[model samples]
Target: MRNNHNDKPQWQPATMTIHGGKQRDEHGALVAPLYQTATFAFSNTAQGSARFAGEEAGYIYSRLGNPTTDELEARIAQLEGYPAGAACATGMGAVSAAMLAFLEQGDHVVVADAIYGCSFALFSHLFAKFGISVDFVDMTNADNVAAAMRSNTKMVFIETPANPHLKIIDIAAVSEIAHRQQARVIVDNTFMTPLLQRPREQGADIVIHSATKYLNGHGDVVAGLICGSAEDIELIKMTTLKDMGATMSPHDAWLILRGLKTLDVRMERHCNNAMRVAAYLQQHQMVRSIYYPGLAEHPAQRLMGTQMHGPGAVIAFELDGDIATARQVLDSLELITIAVSLGDAETLIQHPASMTHSPYTPEARAKAGISDTLVRISVGLEAVEDIIADLEQAFTKAQQLKTIEQTEQTEQQGEPLTYG
Candidate 1:
């Protein structure tokens, strides 16, 4: 460990994650120090001028850069195999800043149709209001994506194993197509995280993350990250992040750094627990469909195996009944919390139609394969048997509710009622 700036060793991923971005002070403490100051004082006016003029390198203000944030950025960049990274205040902030950096008025963007609901709203509502045109396409189909591209197309934005539906897209293929047309490929890697997939190695020009999820591993902090080449990162940071004021706070950055140290271990458990839970749900009589890439029945199983190191923790399944039955299951569950966010240590669940995707009309929701009965579960690091027991109890409760409803209908009609 020579601390050579030019020649770092090619250590394994686990080692890199823990020790990659450490710059120690004179005390030589093992952990990186948090530089909490708002401004950096210069030795002289000439030195300050050089730092400001791009002739030298150093931090002038916390808004621009801080040692704690720099360490977090460096660790993430190394994990994602990128030259540089920019940390932002929130995931939406990262998405907005990155998109605004390269796109201008009258420019067109080809985006994946089944993106995060808020993201879809941002593009369809906010970006459209600014004169930037967007075409939504099924990114899983390469031909459709290529067809959607226009002469003014500046970017192809996608989210693999897309939110809620778990649709898979060929990142390398789309990147190649975009490059041929002189467009950039930006991938939202929030769902998969760096432990599961690295979009940069697969040819994406930029990778973004909602560090509020898996990166923090706790539900306490909200943050965002973007990684790419040094030139591209600096360009976006100077223009969008600086002007828009979406910079991450030093305290949040410190929390993310602490979470990063255990990312590999946490993700392993998440994948393991999720696979077992998905298998159990697939065999349930009340479950209409189960969507988890770890299941061999998944359409994207083969591709996910090829591209990602592990299947993610989130699983979406539809109930055989209606929205009421879905609500019953959520209410009966004793262990898992019903919540919007995911990737925390505790198991969580939510219904997409009435909660996350309520903004979308029925027709729009159907197009994205989101039905009223669809329920999403974010498996946590709980014991497999206990999680299964909770589900079994929930199913029993749902059956009882159906029986009581049938009895009430029979009494009202004054005739025999069929259980089917």
Candidate 2:
């Protein structure tokens, strides 16, 4: 029930975030009020039967449907250009439900190697116990994706500008490969909110988000979203999502709806700040490597431009030393908070080797390209100068204090520090 009044006139994208999917009553409240009921009453028993039998179009219970949650789903679906969407209690809830909807027990799933740690654990341990098989491959190379496909491959799951490492996968290329094999393509579109990238328009069969990150923007709420065709979402709603009972609450839905309003402007500042931070890190003497799609030399630079509007807010880099050095940088930060979640209003930083991706062993992480010295930074809506100053001071302290050696050096021009 989007605010489709003729007077509203279907305002543009920026306006849609504020005014889209709105439902109001005779009171004419400016914002969508919370429909706090756990169940909706029918006029009579026949109406109730019609709702459960799918013969009528009304909510029967909170688990199946709620007005406030429906409005939030409608707005996200419209924004992401998907025919329909579903709300979940957490990001993983959306992810698990989507996979379970299309994939059978014997079906195979091809996933990118550098995915979120918890997702890696899901495929490796949880699904394997249930007879589902998975393959982890580097998706930056389109050929790697194609090679991993099998006749039983039912899905190709990927994350563009992937978690922690910030690697960009070619959505259109992977989607084409999967579709040709008669497989469904699912893209984790969390890092680059719908404002910056549209995976559905790029040929993805489904899109999922850790709405707790960019979609909610603020750190207070936790929610997940799955966006796709009506048929697919209906299947998930009737089966996997519904049976699991991982429905989002009306209050959390309202909070995420509020976050979507400022998402566009917030992302603009985040991208701006991250690009500046990445540039500074690239030239620093104590930094060994930087991973950001915004960097001109990034491996996925060409693909990032064609697939994404911005390089995104998160940046990952490696210090010249080991875990102790990475820990020092986390402790030395004055402005950036030591935290894991990204896309927040405040800058946050974490040591991925011990924090976000710790579920994987050292050997597995290294094979997946996460180094012991890697530091993942979620740049926020802060001044570029202040953020850069904080990083510079941390680098100095981490190198000098941890190793007891001066990090500053008059290295030959055009040469940056290197680590084996």
Candidate 3:
């Protein structure tokens, strides 16, 4: 049974992370026990049939349900302020399950122009093969979303502080527009986990998370979660999740359960470190442009403390030079790891054009405002000063490389290089 928070004073986020969906251990253990098994044994054939028929609430198979995974789902759902949730093997599993469950052939989906690279590929390439049409639009302006909706538009997908660029979309405004046309809003809440922003409370119909990132808060496990009303979650579980076989492993679920206990505090450090990193990038001469909501110069800075509790840990910026310059800086960095994923204890930096968003064609990426020179970083739990110092040295080395390259070019041409 779920813990009854209503019986006591309302739990805060930190408390909720530790104890929200947890049940007392009948064995008098401090931690919830993991139910690692393929299937549960029924009392009798009649009981087995009843479970298969959904006439009784009991685990039939690991794919259909597991006690450990169930607790993870319940914890996330409660954190999202939703009635139910489904855990998946990966973040894309959650995205596909949520969309495929509700969408049908000939259905049109309106989506944010900028989102995770894999998510964009899923809709543009795979969905087309199934006869579903999609329109990628700028959700920052609610009017763009309104204009894109159609009579057959069954869903609208978005990512606030959109991937790689930190573009802030107005969740409530888009939700209002989509709801008017009978479309449900599915929000990818990976960047700003429920600890930072609850999309359901902001009018989103469904919320998705890459449990591989912030939810797991470790580089070890890869998983996903979807939270929504009980009906929607049931629909997803019965359809895509059940048939696709993307259910999360019991071991992974248990790791995430342990990770969630530290989520509230980790998010605090992430936000704090990110704000400082963003500020440093803003004043740096080599950073041509920075896209972090915490910075006052960001167009969507106003959304902070209103739609979101804090400006999350991810930051995207452009260097003074071209893509080569960005690569040089990345290669020169000594401290931050050159990696694709985020929300781990160690800082990670990657080039969106070549790494994460490579699925998008050049034209599509341009339209989405993801420049070839853009660098995205997930500020980690390291000392803020050390992170800045590493970035500072990297930028200096990149500048030195640029000067040497210019000199070599001038020598090869037998003349000084000139700039317009």
Candidate 4:
């Protein structure tokens, strides 16, 4: 059995990352053992019945819980400063299960207009099909959130430094407004991990993460986690997670457990690299606009230290030309990988309009300020100089492509091509 020292001192974040929720087993193994069994053998029929009926606290089945997955859940919950957490198969699973646990037919949800493409689809398309209504509102201004709330609003969902776009939402203000109407507030804390921000302290009812991203720090694992009150977590675990069967694999949880050890150092490197990259992009002539909270000109710069500990590792910027130019820039990158996923050891870039946020129609995307030329990059743990060098080369290639396209257009019109 694992030790639960109730009188343990409050360790710092760095120490907690390595040791939180971990204890030696009967064999005194330094690393926690993975109980990979599907079902635990009961000593007797009475104990089996008691476990099934929730009268006893031992693990009856892996679907209900596993020692490995439980450690992961507890560790993440401790990081987020919540009483409990539930791990899921994917980020969308955590999102769907968290909301579905409390929502019913005729219930309304107020969500930020800018969110992950899958999340937007969940609220705009899938939930609507099931008779649940959602109002997508601009959450940067708390007043917009207040205006969008209805008497039937059961939940308010938001993503601070919202996916791809990097729009910062006021968690405390929105949470306060949601709580007034007896609605739960769920903040997708995927962008800024618990190392940077704790939404629960700011009044958010639950904190969610796409653990596939920063939490894992490596790109191999595809997983999600939600941290909240013990009651809310139990409800999600019993209903959506148990019946829907989006349980996280014990192996995956073990990988995340390993990843958590270096989270503090990884996040620090990510932030430093991103801040340098955002500055470089800001000065590039081929770039139209840059969105990163670390930049001085960022609209949400004032909220940096107050809301989040750092600006985070993602940067979104628009190219000077059209969608083709943006695509060329991504295609021309030599070192950076062109993948939609973020928070990896390798730097990655992707176009949101055709990639991550394509779930939204053109009209809806335009309304959400996602332009066709916008490109999002998840600045990885790469050396800052190497990351910037790759971007510089890509921009040079994109600019050359633009020049050729312009020259060809002039020739087609029977006009002399003017050189700049």
Candidate 5:
């Protein structure tokens, strides 16, 4: 049951997404059927031995591979312009496995400073404990990254339009520099799905995703994917993923496959909604600053235009007051969920200072441009007017809280006259 859809030259991305990696069983089902068995039954002892010895290209165990997961992997690889891909249990699982497989104790890694908070912690804490030194750099500065690279550097890790801040990095430039130094370039492409930006096309050796995000288009499941050359993927699969046991579940893979079918449509709507939200935030008096690549005011707007098809769904803004005010706004929101993760069907608003990056020291958070007043929002597929109205109400509530705090402080100061 082999599908040769990839060999067809006439097929485009949208077409490939629907019919790309599908292989029919004997029943001739149009959709790829899920093989739920733990181990494959062999016709004879020799066949089983050969299958175990890698003499045959059939599934030996569900832990290693499944037909439904394979179809999803192949489809994602085709969409990403990669030779192959591997699905993992979660996005961080993919990141950790890729790093552990490729890097050694003595190796060094150069990472973007503005990355997901957990990813930052993984490198700064976990990798460091293993004697793998990681150097964090502002990827927007090519020269800074170049200077940070050492002879022992094995990989340069980055997330473009970085997690909360939306800082853009020149993927091509960074990849070239890393490659010249004999370092592999790994990009977290969670923010911009392959439909919007293909990191492999820009010279990335590997592209990773928290498919829990846009790939799922809903907050129901947690999944991850890694795309790279077949050889590189095989190495990671044989080593980290196999030993660490971070394989994605069959059910999650199936759900993600369903989500992939509508990925292009969902992302288009997400980008459109995000742009409107960013515009509205930029004009609001309460918003001290907005960080969105779509706006001309953004520092990386030009680079984003060159490297990405669109600005993506996430937006970050700073409040005129402080962290307390930011929390007030989040607490007041009726339509948006105050959750930690992003890229869901419903809008989610979070304060990184108190929520995501709270584990990091204040100085470290400052270095990453995560300020006390900063608020991050993952705009969803909701109606633009309704989303704006919810935000408006939140802003009103936040202002009321601010006014009360100021009045209380003034009264306390007035009462201090008796103490003198």
Candidate 6:
């Protein structure tokens, strides 16, 4: 929307979720109609030339922009309280565009040691080949980030309530360090979403999300978003997004737009269920370590509480035994899904070491805090009691099977096994 004297009223979160940044069609459809066309028609050659010359606001092709996608981007920007944003075909699309948009061949990027596996690969491989250097640092300590910053550093990238481990990074602290070096700060707010944590408000220059996960919430679409100032988004739109052709489809954008309407309430239930599940796991004998920041024992509890409204749905815990036993417990889960993706309505669980982060070397995985015995669960909207009951039974089954396996191994070795 262009700036005008009759600007719409800015609503609060609840009200915005239902009515913010809407582009009403002539039919007055309550839900935005899916404009599934690839090309838009102009009234005349002069009008088309005007659009191409930037004198008019109009979409020429779906690859550059689509009405449906624009509506979603507008809504996301509104929710993030940013001047502009871009919706992309997939989560990595947004990540790649945001990085390539600002980075030059000799520029350096400082990133948190923990991020999505693909993000690490993109930085370590593709970006490296182009002469862009990246430093992966322990961002939990603000000083570590400050120390990593260089005169050549152009961006500081981080993920809060970070992937798999749920380590909370102080966005304000890192942003403070980056701004001193004249570097931009970009944060992946996938885990907590804007409802729980708004990174832009915490001094971050840009915010990105895997809209496929919590943003969609129904496991139906793969999408991403980048939120920042209009000038930054425009640079990405005209270059990386347009040339790479990572534009979100009209249908996918529509689905994500639908998701925005319920994000506030769904996040509320997600946080509530996760807190209950994390509390239950902490006291369980089979659980060796709990990685939910909501727990008081978590190293980042104070910082997390200050930065975010809640800990969110994803929780990581390590087992008392080996990878075999962890797999056994995951396989034994009847209610919780054994899928890799998170933020679905159904409970989903997976081992990051063998699943998401399998592409990384053992040392790399270790540095990222992904362990063989670790299991990450995306707590769902199910009744807290039922979710806990399912885990309880699975843990009991895992222990029994693990004991049997140990006994058999002992017998094979001809060692007399004694009772503990």
Candidate 6 lDDT over residue span 1-420, tens digit each: 332221244577766766767875776567888989999999999999999998998889998888788878887888788988898999999999998989989999998988888988898888889999999999999999878888999999998888878888999989998999889999999998887888888899999999999989999999899999999999999999999988799999999889888888998999899999999999999999999978888876676646787788999999999998898999999898899888889899999999887876799889988999989999998998999999999999998997898899988889666998
Q: TM-score of every model? A: 0.95, 0.92, 0.96, 0.97, 0.95, 0.95
Backbone clash total, candidate 1: 0
Instruction: Give the C-alpha lDDT of model 4.
Output: 0.91
RMSD, each candidate, Å?
Answer: 2.8, 5.7, 2.6, 2.4, 2.3, 2.7
Poorly placed runs, candidate 5 (over 4 Å): 2-4, 8-10, 415-420
Best by TM-score: 4
lDDT of each: 0.88, 0.86, 0.92, 0.91, 0.87, 0.88
Off by over 4 Å in 2: 1-11, 403-420
Query: How many clashes in each candidate?
Result: 0, 0, 0, 0, 0, 0
- What clash pairs does model 5 have? none
Q: Can you write out model 3's per-residue Cα lDDT over 263-335, one digit (the tens) per residue? A: 9999999999999999899999999988998877787767778789888999999889998999899999999
How big is the positional error of residue 104 in model 2, measured in Å on the Cα after superposition? 1.6
- Predicted model with the maximum lDDT: 3
Q: List, residue by residue over 1-420, the lDDT tens digit for candidate 4.
A: 777532223977777778887766878887768787888999999999998888998988888999999889988888888889999999999999999999999999999999999999999999988899999999989999999989999999999989888999989999999999999999999999999988997899998999999889889999999999999999999999999999898988999998999999999999999989998999999998889988887777777777888889999999998988998998999999999999998999999999999999998899899999999999999889999999999999888888998899988889666999
Q: List the residue pairs that clash in candidate 4.
A: none
TM-score-superior candidate, 3 or 6: 3
Model 3, total clashes: 0
- Tens-digit lDDT string for candidate 1 (1-420): 113232244966777767777665567667776677888999899999999998988888888888889888888888888989999999999999888999899999999988788888888889888899998888888998889999999999999888887888989889989998889999999989887898987899999999999999998999999999999999989999989989998989989988888888988899999999999999999999989888888867767656787889999999999989999999999998999888999889999888887767787788889998999999898897888889889999999999999999988989666796
Which sections of candidate 6 miss by over 4 Å? 1-10, 413-420
